[model samples]
Target: MPLFVAQYPIGINSHVEAIILQLEIGSDDVCMLGMYGPGGVGKTTIAKAIYNKILDHFEGSSFLENVRDKSGTFDGIIQLQEILLRETLGMNGQLKVCSESKGAIAKENILRHKKILLILDDVDKLYQIERLIGGFDWLASGSRIIITTRNKHFLQTLRICHSTYEVKELDDHEALELFSMHAFHKNKPEEDYSNLTDQVICYAKGLPLALSIIGSNLHGRSEIEWKSALDKYKMIPDKDIQKVLQVSYQGLDETEQDIFLDLACFFKGIYKDYVVDILNSCNLYPVIGIKNLIDKCLINVDQFNKLWMHDLLQQMGREIVQQESPKIPGLRSRLWCYKDAFEVLTENKGSDNIRGITIISPKLAKLQLKAKCFEKMGNLKFLLVGNVDTCGDLEYLPNGLRVLDWSRFPSSSLPSNFRPHNLLVLDKPQSPVILDKIFEFRRKLEVPQNTKYEDNILMDSHSHRKLSHQIDYSSKIDFSHSLIKPLSTLHAFMMDSIMDYEESYNIIVTGKKIPKWFNHQSIESSISFWIGPKFPTIAVCFVFHLVPLKDSYANNDKYGSIHNDEICWNCHVNIFTNDHTQPLTLQRDFYSMKCDHLWFYSNSHSKFQRFFRNMMQGDRNLVEISCKISWWSSRNKKFAPVIARMGVHAECICHPPNSVIIDDNSDYFENVDDSSDDN
Candidate 1:
């Protein structure tokens, strides 16, 4: 059989071959070699392979496996030292070593003159190495020492093991061969099981332990049996592989265990800073806890600072949670499964044990909820309830709630007595009832009066209900392109063009954000940028949030909320050709807005040719142009600064000169507390 444990360690990993090249077996100095990666990645096999190849050159050698588990304490260290002395000295009985003396007597008596080869396999802590081979001054020159570990930092901390190499997972080709060796007893998969083998490879994600265990289990089974087993493994992983991968997790401390399980269960692929904020709010000292987890090779941080772990590790953590309350999910600490969350909220089966919950069903089903659906859960910390279609208002939310992201929230306002002093994030991106205002602000342009708009509102924690005008993303507005909401990408600004403009795509290079950002800082902000003579197609995209629309009278709430639904405001878009006071107006102001919208005004190449012809009729050379958005009350009264994310795009152009010259002339109007609309 070609099983890895039974057969010679050949063709199992490419990293083994690469590492063998760096061993320098014939070198004249003591070489310290270290190999590190997550558990079950074949570190032991590679060490054995190198040891066997170079053992003939050494006077004596020994390969000690599982040193981390074997040499944990002083008593354990003495036991391991006795074994090391017996094997390397070619002795038949126990050596003279004690827990109090450590390896002091053995180092002098056993290895005073001979050149030796020593391999410490799976060494997690430093004591294992210190006791087994202390200082290594006793062994003769040209001797070699090797250590294999799951923790890279464990080896990195030792100056002796400076030549550490990271042993990553297998590539697609290597993974396939490794699986085939165990299943088919050959170099490749059976002809009939090619696609199934590919699926297995994808599931294993190149973890050798998973591949071998799963492949061996499915060997000699019929095609139907293979299909059934694969389906079964989707929900329930194999016990053999889980046992091996969970070893690292089982070694963590209590707080580190909580941090690891939390990341593996809920925060995989989430930004590190955001995860830290959420976990720190729960009193989990995540800074040192996360470092411990990394040192153990249980988790990793990607280039973008997102936390991710091996798929098997993540599955293992979820399995641990499932075991916490196998039949009851609400009794568990965290809930991300939609069905579990739906049952807890719908049946009110939640308890104070529930710390965090998220219900993001793939199909987006609306669960009917009572006014006090979350009353029983008193210790709830974070909630991301989605699409609760209810008639009456929500009565109570846990005062301990910290992060609230309720999607499609039906109520016009939060619970009457809900105090969010501990709330860090209260985000309701597209909830229809956050604010009950239909403020549609646009340029001064005439349109039909009968235009339907979604109701949008904004409120603050410090003020009472106040309705304000919002933009309606309907066809009645003077927009040349279709309206799309929730683009979902941060800093996503690009011009989608129709015609080919690659012929003249040269742009001046500058070190700034193109189509510069003027959102979130002011109600109205303007910028000027230099445009070429041949104006490429431009796309104007903006993200505006008038939710809890701020007013002059409301004491700027910490969470920036305002009471009332029907907010009244007008948006003014003016263009300037290097001018200070007057505007080159080509459109009219739009009235009545209703929701937080991401407005993408796309223009065809022909439309761009015609637009520049109209706006810049006289001065058509390469010049700086400015676009401004000003917000005023419907009755021409000045309003608070409108906060929105606006980005300018030129689709066919790859690079453009960026400029951000903000002009904020919003000091003329007084704060308006007169609620009586005199329009």
Candidate 2:
């Protein structure tokens, strides 16, 4: 038995027992077992322990170490084959199996009769197994083959493993013990050093290899030295540990590696599906690449489908980019450090190699850059600047940008010649840019007519309805020339609403009245109207006029008698039958310093229509639509916005229920007058 198996102090007993049970090692049946996890998670250590415990029972055994690394060399597979053959057959000299065919012959003729225990350590590829033992039939009964790898997909592809176990990081107790064993050369830390020891363990984050390496490196150091080391680890990880963890990253192909680096640099903690869409638009083959990364333990997706990477791995990725240009931020492939990005922008030190940059600093001083700072960064794809006050013309932006999430962009409008056709996300929440420029940009943008929404409509239950006859109010309102055009970018706002219905449609503009196209209008916050039976289309529009205040007043006070830019309004719309049975409700948040109008439409086949039909089943003849508005100060939550004016418009396309004569030019609901009810 290996001495380390007995001497290894932390967690492994449960893992060993579980693997033994999963493999059914006690039974006399041929089985294959796999131990898989991220690099430095002790996959190899556990496999060795299992191998040592059961070596006495097998007639022949061979442990192939570093198979992933050695297999990359010339004839590496044949060399591994020879080791397996020599050990299992008890041969003194090398075998004659130079080629794959000879190796198959050797396995069939000699090793078939022997009961063997073979452990392939750090195996990464399928060909390594196929070129070595070939199959379980090549060995005698009761034989067990164990493989250790960083990727579980490798075992899945081979289909040889009867069972696979994922090796997890140590718990807090075990991690402290293991770390103390090396740091203090004891099982527990001294009473005076307990706090510092806990800090180290927390930084290690339960990774056994990191705890071991860090403990060993900091052994016999003073308290001051320990603090300095921990601080240093935050900025630059230990080179020894980084090298071990980077092997899995290096195993990825070029495109997979790019996805990994991007996640590490920019997208960590973001929703996984959203990241996939962005990367897929970049032509990165994200679906397969992300799967491989997860299999290799390079990244993880939580239950909420958010991407997460270990802190050590994230640091290692940033370090790799840092090495590209030790002093020059412009030469690096990605930049996330606040100081580095600030310097790159202010000094106009951008290069074509810079693919992505993110600057988020709440404490950094204001910065101003020239218009041509990004002119040379032709390959830039992702750019995000947050919290920092950046002032520049932004005359030159990379044409191939996929995401531009610059909050507080100083320019009034993007350059006329600048192209945004490749953009997947343009998130400028508090930007002062004019909406007309955005409308023009959207007009120039190429949108695929056959989008997934259209496909969904075709496949829906209302496929029999003629979608062509559905009225599209957006087409009739010349967005470029409309009065409301200055208040909102119609295309981008609509696209955002279509993408995520829960999120608010925010825009900054100045207006006081609803558009004239709406047939029905009211000045109250809440409006109720009666809907007849034959109405095919129903549209509701709400207009809000914002009152601006000084920055200090908005920031200092939480709740006052008036509303300002700091207030966030919660808007709700509900529809019910005449009997007060609710059929539909819509809620959204409204924020910004400009006047804006929110519009909602329901056609013959829309969800509202379906719900209305179901709710008004049998002989229900009347429907009531109600709109309500309330606001609270986002900063204090106690203050409410004072409504300058709130307007609602309800338009019905078809005739009233009992009206016999239908005039194309006459209003459908003009004769049915009802008092405005405010809630």
Best by lDDT: 2
Candidate 1 Cα deviation (angstroms), residue 472: 23
For model 1, the run of ten residues with the poorest summed lDDT: 503-512
> lDDT by residue for model 2 over 381-492, one digit each (tens)?
9888766788768788888887777766777666767776666566564454443343222232221222111000011112112221221222222223222122111111
lDDT of 1: 0.59
Among these predictions, the greatest TM-score belongs to 2
Check candidate 2 and list the clashing pairs.
Answer: none
Per-residue lDDT tens digits of candidate 1, residues 304-393? 466778888888887887788989998898787778888988888998888778777665576777889889889988787554544456
lDDT, model 1, position 543: 38
Per-candidate TM equals 0.66, 0.71
